[model samples]
Structures are given as C-alpha cells and as structure tokens.
Target chain A: MPRDEFERLDSTWASVTPPAARRMLIAAAAAFSARGYHGTTTRDIAAEAGMSPAAVYIHYRSKEELLFQISRIGHATSLSLLTAVTGDDPVARLASAVRVFASWHAEYRTTARVVQYELSALTPEHLAEVAELRRGIEGAVREMVEAGVAAGAFDVPDVRGATLAVLSLCIDVARWFQPDRGRTPAEIGDLYADLVLRMVGAKAP
Target chain B: MPRDEFERLDSTWASVTPPAARRMLIAAAAAFSARGYHGTTTRDIAAEAGMSPAAVYIHYRSKEELLFQISRIGHATSLSLLTAVTGDDPVARLASAVRVFASWHAEYRTTARVVQYELSALTPEHLAEVAELRRGIEGAVREMVEAGVAAGAFDVPDVRGATLAVLSLCIDVARWFQPDRGRTPAEIGDLYADLVLRMVGAKAP
Candidate 1:
C-alpha cells in the first residue's frame, strides 16, 4: 500500500456518495451479485432492500436498467479505487494497485461476482457499455505497466499479458475467499499485492 | 504437458466415451453451462440432445444426478490434464501444467463454464464431492510449488498463495477468451504459461 495510491482511491470516494442512491445501489448490487441477472427479478432486489417491487421501478425502468446501474457503479468504484492508489513510482503504483484491487474484491465480493459472471445476460447494448467500462479499468492498468516498463521498473515481454495476470489475481479472489477461511481480507490483500508486484518483476520492497 | 498427465486424461476419455453417455453428458454440460443448473429444465437438455424428455430420466435418475455426472467428468478431466503435464523439473512442470490447463479450458469451454458457474446449484453432497475433486487438483499444484522452492527453482514465501495465483490465471481464461479474440488457444496458452512461470520466479527456458 503506497501512500500515493491510497490518496488516489480516497479522492474517487469523495465524488460518489449520495446516501439514498448509494443504499439502493448496494442492495441492487447484492441481489445481482447473489443471483445471475436473469435469475434475479426486481422483486428480489426490492425484497432485499425492504421495499415493494413497484418501488424499484420508480428508480429503474426495468430489470436490465437495474443491472446497468449496478454494473456502472461497480465498475466506477473499482476504477476509482485503482486510480486513487496509483503513484508516481511504477513499482509502488503496481503494488498499491494490487492491494487496493484485492481489498475491493473482498469488500464487494458479491457485486464483483455478479459483474464478472452475469455479463452474458446483459442486452447487447448494455453488454457493450459494460464491456467499455471494463476496458477502461484494464486500460488504466495497462498504462501503469507500460509506464513501469518504460522506467525499467518491470521486465515483461507483453504489458497486456502482465495486466491480465494482475487482474486475474484480484478477480479470482471471490471464487475461493471465505470470511472464516483462516486469513483476513487485508492479509490476503497484502500477500497478493506482493506476489503480483514480484510477478511483474518489481523490486522487492 | 507431461506424458503422465496426457496418459491419465486419455484413460478418462476412454472410460467415459460410450456414445450414449458421452452425447448425453455433452448436451447436459452445454445446457447447464449456458442456462445454469436450476435455470435449465430437464426438457431443455433432452431437447438439446434431440431425445424425448423421458429419455433423460431413463439414463439419469434426476436433474441433480445429471449435474453431478457433469461435475464429475469436468473435474476428472482437469485433474487428469494436470497429472499428464507434470515433469521432473519444477519449472518445466509448472509451465507444462498451465499450458495444458489453458488449452483445455479453450477446447472445452462449455464444460469448463458449467463446472465453474453452476456449482452453487448443486446439492450439498454433490458440492462436497466437487470440492474434494478441486482440492486434489490444488494439492497437486501446491506440491509442485513446494518442490520448486525446495529445488531453488522458485522464490515464494507462501506456497498456497503462489499456487492460487497460478490456478487463477488459467481459470479466468474461460471467461474472456473467444476464438475470434485475435489469439488462438495455443497462443493464449503459451502466453499464460509464460506469465505463470514468471509469477513463481521460475527461469525462462
């Protein structure tokens, strides 16, 4: 966890908090994450939120719309988390990015799971939009890796491959991580951040 | 891939290739993979197989049984692939294992997808069985990492974390890979093999 990267994430957090919308987004994210989009109805979301199903329609036009909203928020939050942690030094930036990523996945496991797993169920239009959001996140990581390579802080033949490796390490956390699985999320996050930094040939801190 | 892993996979292939059962399993795997287990009806699998709905019941006792069968085959195939690729040299063994894994996920994307995405829909007994099978595969990888460390071929403080990083890279291929995505399966396999090898701090060939 580099100090600079932590500041980047904190700044993103500052721009995105409206109490009511945040609560609705959290409920919607949980439902969408627990069940696949097609498998979850608006009623399920409303029930999770302790509101009537009709109340959901007031905020979102349709099921697809709700999914879109969730996807957008989830993607933005992840990007912001990454953006917040990026530092001037590529090695510190990479390690901090991995730390933020692993922690975010653990904290928002359900939302992350739904966004990753349920992409196929989105309408073509919505799917493209989600894909774009994903690419934005990937692109930012790629830029960091390229910068690292330029500064000789990393040694990799392919920046794209390194980006995928880093992202995969974080995304797969949701698959096996259990709250009672003998390791705290922060511990796992720190270990993974170190592993990823080394994977990219970053000097040991 | 190691010759032993290849032999094991060949053996499993031989045992599971009775035409009727193979066809049924393939059909069920595709349906389960696409629509998920609970979301997919027995009639859907029957229709996909071009058999009467009753035909499915004749072969398998219940939908749950069908899923269990698919899970068994999928896990067995993955384990066999790993066993086939392991070598005496820890670095070569790790690279070969990951190459086989990535290639298998590409070739059997549907089966891989079903085995991964539909786990939550399985009965408790079935889930435990699948979990055991997964543990066996993870154990094999962990042993390889331990061997690598013992041989001074790799540098990692945590064997379990290193193993997870390697597995995560391969497992995620099923999600974002497409034949039309500009890289052939072999290319993707090779690229990922290199990444995993480096992640463990193995020397390049």
Candidate 2:
C-alpha cells in the first residue's frame, strides 16, 4: 500500500548537518524547481534562505555545487530506497521497487526535478559524481528485472530496453506530477507497479 | 522495419516561413538543447544563425518568443504525426502510434528537448496554446488505448493509468536519447511498440 502523506520538504535534507546549510540547500532546490539552474543565482538562493549571498558562498563553492549536493543526496536516497526492498519473489520485489521509486519522485518532486532535469548544468566533475549514483539506481532496477526473467516469473525479450522504459516512466513523475491534480504519489506508484509488471509480462500479482 | 536514417533537424520546422526566421528558430533550438532556455541569450541565437541581435527581433519579439515558436511547432508536428497513423486494427494502430511517437522524440531530439523539457519557460499565453496541442497528444494515445480495450484486444485494468504510462514512456525518450549510443530511434520505436503492446496486454503483433 502507498503512504497517505507527502514527505516534508526538509525531510530529505535532514542529514545535512548545520541547520543554516540545510536551509540554503532547501532554498536552492525550491528556486531551481521554479526557475531553471541558469535562471537561478546564488543571491536568489541566499535570499530565499534568508541569508546573505556571501553566506551561500561560505556553505557551497557555487550554485552548481548546491545543485550537485541536491542531486547527489536525492539520487542516493532513491537508490537506497530501491535497494532496500525486502522480498525473495522477483515479481513482488520488482513491484515494490517501482512503488517506492515512482512515489519518491512524486513525494520529493521539488528535489527530483532538480536532480533529474538539471544534469547538463552540473560541471563535469559534479555530473560524474551524480552519474555514479544514477548507474547504481539503473543497476538496481536491471538486476530485479533480470532476476524475474531468470526465475521465469517474467517474459522479456529485451531486458535492457524494458529496464529503460521502467526507469523512464518513474523518473518522469517529477516533470508532470501535480499535487492537486491526477492520482496521489502512492496511487501513481500502485498504478505504475501494475503497468510495469504487465510490461515485463509478469502475471497479475 | 525501422528507418535507415534519422530525421533531418530542420524537417520538422520546414513549414515555418521566411528562411531567415526558420534559421533563427533552428539556432534557438540547438542553443536551448545544449545550454537550456534560461542559459541562452538572443546574442547567442543571432551568433548561431550568423545574424545580428536586431535581426532576431525582426523575426521574434524576445528570447521567450523564439522558445514559443520552437515549442509550438514541435508539439503540433508530433500531434499530427501521431494522429496520422493508418490502420483499422487497434493493436496495430496503437503499436504504430507508439513507434512513430517514440522515434520522433529521438529523431528530432533537439526540438523534442525544448518541447518536452522547456515547457515551464513558455509564457502563459504561449503555454495555453501549446497545452491545447498537448491535450490532443494525450487524447490521441488515450483513444488508441480505449480502442484496444473495447475490441477485447487489450486487458488494461486502468485505461487512464495505462495511457499515462505509455505516453510517459515515449515522451521520456527525449530526456535520455543519444545518437552515438544505444539503439537508433527507429529501433527504439520497434522495441517500444512491442513493450507498449505488452503494457496494454495485447498479443504480439
């Protein structure tokens, strides 16, 4: 079953010690979500966080660093959520992964938007760091799909393509998810879990 | 079978009149694709098109207007391509639609990137115009899904959810497509057609 509540904005950043730095990161995320990375400046983030622009520089080297922090943390959180699924059955495990993955995008869309869409804005070094986390995320999904195929619980002709489709479907929730419109994050997770199972030719669970 | 070559970049914008205006739009699309809308400036578009900043205003009112033209044309062209698919069989028609839609995102990824990701930057008036076309795109896919369900060709437990998933999967092709890596757009179309058929629970075509 899906969760009944949305995640608090600061919940994702709780691990970042120093309340001031966390506030700056949250402010940067909201600004980036509303405005593209290029459209946002350190002053905008600092202002949003109720700090001086110099204060932002003290916490992060540049706006890109702030973005990198958000992307790295967001990707790590989703990856951990996905790999933490507990189940021996491939079908059930894959379904649970999709449920949490899809819901995470919706639950933390503000951060997800910056994480998923702001890749090009990151410096090569920052992007390379985030890409590692992304690969882990991709590998986690691919392994589950492979497990299902190996166990004869699913029939997939192209495992890689199927994996791409599943990840693409879930990541896009950040682009179009509206809190007031359509299904809740959990409902979307449930719906996507079913569709993904069908995509892999898994029987209804 | 998939096509041997990708669609020309200007092919989608061929209908735009006055060669100069079309050149500016193409330049804007490339700039937007690489640097993003917020990062691009009129000087960059003019420089890319080998024209002066004033020449841009002659063709466009502002940078946002250039973005609007690219977005509006891109959305309309995809909508037309989707709605133009032939065949009376729901299974075949839906497959064909997914094939063309998915490949279009890849073949014309420059424009597709601006169309799919740069939507938040469109002016309210321009967004309203594009939203109409988006609704058409969404409705076209939903109708195809509904047709398959009605003909007993598909076993979709949730028509709306299924439609959203199929469109989401195809639309996301623009976000991750690379010319040098992975399958060609046409191959992706073919694979996606098969996967989408599975998604709707239709027997293989």
The candidate maximizing lDDT is: 2
Docking class of 2: medium
What is the Cα-based lDDT of residue B45 in candidate 2? 90
DockQ of each: 0.46, 0.65
Residue B81 miss distance in model 1 (angstroms): 0.9
Position B54, candidate 1: lDDT: 90
Residue A1 CA displacement from its true place in model 2, Å: 27
Task: Give per-residue CA lDDT, model 2, range A61-153, as digits (tens).
Answer: 889889999889989999899989968899999999999999988877777877877898889998899899999999999999999999999
lDDT of 2 by residue, B63-104 (tens): 999999988888888899999996889999999999999998
Tell me the deviation in Å of residue B60 in model 1.
1.7
- Per-residue lDDT of candidate 1, residues B1-205 (tens digit): 2233334434445666565655566677767666666557889988877888998877788988888887888898899888787568998888888888887777666667778877877889989999999998999889888998899998778888888778877887776777676777788789887877777888655
Q: Comparing chain B with the reference, what is the TM-score for each candidate? A: 0.89, 0.94
For model 1, fnat equals 0.38
